[model samples]
Target: MRMHTRIVPLAMTTALLAGGTAAMATGAAGAAEPKGDVTAQSCYGSARNYTGTPGGPGRNAHWPATGTYAYATRNCTDINLKVNYTRDVRVCFKNTGQCNGWKKAKKGVWKVAASNVRDGAGFYIQFKGANRSTGKIAY
Candidate 1:
C-alpha cells in the first residue's frame, strides 16, 4: 500500500492568511456612517451598528436572510473583508458575519453601497465573532 500526504489547497491557505489580517490593522472605523471603505480612521467606533436594522438604506441590509453577511464579535479577528461598492464601494466589517446582508464580494467588483460612516465599520474574523458599527465617527 502507498501512503499519500495531504496538502492544503492554495486557496485555503490564502483564506487562512486573510482571516489573520484584521488583528494587524492600525486604524479604526468612524461613526455617523463610514464615508469610504479605506478611511484613515480605525473601526473602533460604531461597527456594531452594522448588524442592526436601523431602518434605512445605510443599514447593513439583513445578513443571509436578505443578504450574505452573518453576525459575530471578533474585536480584532482576521478574515476576508473588503471595500464593497454595490452602490459606491462602502466599507463593511468583512471580518466574518460582517457583510452577510449582501452577496460575497466579487473580484474587482463592488458589493457594498458605500461607507455611510455611521452605517459601515464592523469586523468578521473568518465566519466567527462578528462585530457591527458603534456609531462613534465624528462627521
Candidate 2:
C-alpha cells in the first residue's frame, strides 16, 4: 500500500508539471505583438515621428544634422530610412558594429536600412550634403 501511494503521487506530480509546461508554451506562442509609435529627433531638433504599425514601417518629418541617433520611446526590431534628397544613409545598432549599408537616399520614400537589428539599436545617417532631409523611417 505504501509503494502504491507513493507511485500515485509521483504520477500526479508529473502530470501537473507537464500541464504547466504546455501552458507556458502556449503563452509564449501567443505573445502580444508590439504596439504604439516611436519618435526620435535630429541633432538640430527636427522631430521625426514614426507613425506606423508598431514594429512595422512608417514615415516622419524632415530632419537635420549628421550623427548617431536612437529612439527615446521603446526598443525596435528593425529599421529603415528614406529622404527627400539624394544622399547616403545607414542605420546601426548603437555602440555596436552592426549596421546597414550606405544606400542612396530616395526622394520622400522609405527604403530598407537595416534588418535584424538589436531590439533597441540606434541609427547612423550619412548625409552626403545639404545637411537636411525629409521622409519616412520604418521601425
Scored by TM-score, the top model is 2
TM-score to native of every candidate shown = 0.17, 0.42
Shift in Å, residue 129, candidate 2: 2.6
Model 2, residue pairs in steric clash = none
The residue-by-residue lDDT of candidate 2 on 1-139, one tens digit each, is 9999999999999999999999998888767433333232221123254321111123322232234365522333445565656557665455775655677767775565665665555555444443455555555
Q: What lDDT would candidate 1 get against the real structure? A: 0.33
lDDT of 1 by residue, 1-139 (tens): 1222224466677787787665444233324455765332343332332222222344433232333444333332222233222221132455433443333444333233323323334432111122232221121
Model 2 poorest 10 in a row by lDDT = 52-61
For model 2 the TM-score comes to 0.42
lDDT of each: 0.33, 0.52
- The total number of steric clashes, by the backbone 3 Å criterion, in model 1 comes to 54
